[model samples]
Target: MQAAAPDLWHHYGRTRADTDRGVPDFFPWIWAQDGGPGSEVLGDVTGLVLADLGAGAARHAAHLVVHHAPARVDAIDASAAQHAMAGDLYGHLAPRLRTLHANAAEHLEAHPDEYDVLYSVFGGLDFADPRRLLPAAARALRPGGLLAAATLGHYLGGAPAEPDVQHADIPARTPDGTPATMRRWVLQEHVWTKLLDEAGFTAIGVDRLPPATSGARSADTLLLRARRHK
Candidate 1:
């Protein structure tokens, strides 16, 4: 199924900078912490193949270009708008960085076993079907490849069907059309480990990026790092 959110696209495209400013402390902090994703953990990427699933506006892709300087970096997202912005943001790193427009599932299926590092940040895997997508993600990476994903952790049971009240500070629509809101589906740490194990990844690690300070829900993040086992 496609998780197209035209309304969200319109909302984000029109006010990304403002939105980023409004929630500057949280999103930027989290993005920077993951080294914008690949850059933080995937060291020695000079010649490694890297792919960012549902890369969104590719804030992480932009970071990878400057830090890891990988031989090849492919950023795929279903949103044309986000892809376009990523293209511009990564222009300085042209040829080494490329943007593709396609759903994460389709892209992973089309390029099975093609990358050394497969990951996603603040996009894609946020949905409930990560169980179905993780294997495909694992299949898309070469043997011994790494998969680093950052998702919102849902401390309670079952995916929440409603928007989260905890993220009241963010003032824009979710990349999904819901009012600038958080979905209660934030997963717990155990659920993330189980998903990676079932998908055939070893050395799985699941933990939270604690909020920048006490009593702040905005910067909380759940991180999952796993390596494929042949």
Candidate 2:
């Protein structure tokens, strides 16, 4: 159920704010890293229920609610620091956006209530163990609920042809502003489909996001969209 080692992720949360500040002048405007472009790949939720797994600071959730208009969004993150930062950054979205500092699987298990949609942007689906995450997603979403997720296109250990786990790195700045690394989970494309099917989801699509024109990042990141139906 662990996505990142506690100390590593907590340190990441602690130092993330400062590192994000270094991104050009504008972020969500000048660049979009997480979900890519917009919520279009998420299909159409309109006024349906949705949850953002590993929602981080909720910029995407804010976009959906303000621009796309989901009935409500549960912004769930395993990091308390990250959750707090979300509140501080998007307090204006209170009530409409609810933040939950809980593990992705535990949160879904406890709630049990079904959601119309469950999605992530470079989020839990990318790092959390699919055995734990996908099944729990089955419990959390209503029949036919859509599940969409995006992650860095390539795996650090090369493309996975089977159900394999590889180490992933998230670059970060030290508390002293020095370079550092964080760990995460990376999986193969086929494994993802199998996991989703085993979890009670019907595979819908899997696409690799193309790199930006500037070539700042590679086209290695991939998107996985699935649906849970009875």
Candidate 3:
């Protein structure tokens, strides 16, 4: 979690303020990275319960509440600081937007078949082992429920597939700026399709959105929408 901040900041620093005041600017890009509103893939969830694994300041959760208007949303993340920020951001959502401090992979075990939509946005799935995380997410969703995620493309390791404006060569650091050994996985199209299939998702839709940037460092990210088979 802490390890991934430097890369996040490097790519978003220009648009995102280094402090709380900058969170708003940061969210649009985050939402964009997520391949637009979740409903485009997950179908409608107007009255269904939702869970945002790796809620990360709860930007997506807020969007779900505002746009999709789900009955409830359990926004989960591993970082306390992020949780605190989420609490501050969507605290007013009440009974609708709930914040949870937990790792997405382990947290799902406590919530088997609980959500109509179990989703993530550039969260645990892309940062950790996707194979393990997808299965866990599958276990948490109700039958026929949705599992949506957006992640880094496989080409990030070598060269930019498009242009990136906020690119920088910085060490992976915490929000406070301490360096850590970050863990990130960049997966190709086939690798993602195979992983989702192995996770018990029946109707899976994996697509590559336009690049986040168009500069020399632009690498495409993948968006996945998989449904849990009954």
Give the best candidate by lDDT. Answer: 2
Tens digits of per-residue lDDT, candidate 3, 1-230, equal: 45443333333322332454322322232323532433456567788898888777787677777777689999998777677777876788868989998878888877799888987777777566666778888899999888878776644444532232122232466555666555566666667777789889888777777664565555555777788998
Question: Is 2 or 3 the stronger prediction by lDDT?
Answer: 2
lDDT of each: 0.66, 0.70, 0.69
Question: What does the lDDT read for residue 197 in candidate 3?
Answer: 90
Relative to the true structure, candidate 1 reaches a TM of 0.74
Could you tell me which 10 consecutive residues in candidate 2 have the lowest summed lDDT?
22-31
**lDDT (tens digit, per residue) of candidate 2 on 44-133:** 778888899998877668777776767888899987767887777666777777888889988898766468988887788766877888
Every model's TM-score: 0.74, 0.78, 0.78
How much is the lDDT of residue 180 in candidate 2?
73
Give candidate 1 regions above 4 Å deviation. 1-7, 13-38, 155-185, 214-219
- Candidate 1 vs candidate 2: the lDDT winner is 2
Backbone clash total for model 3 is 4
Q: Give lDDT for model 2.
A: 0.70
- How far in Å is the alpha carbon of 162 misplaced in model 1? 12
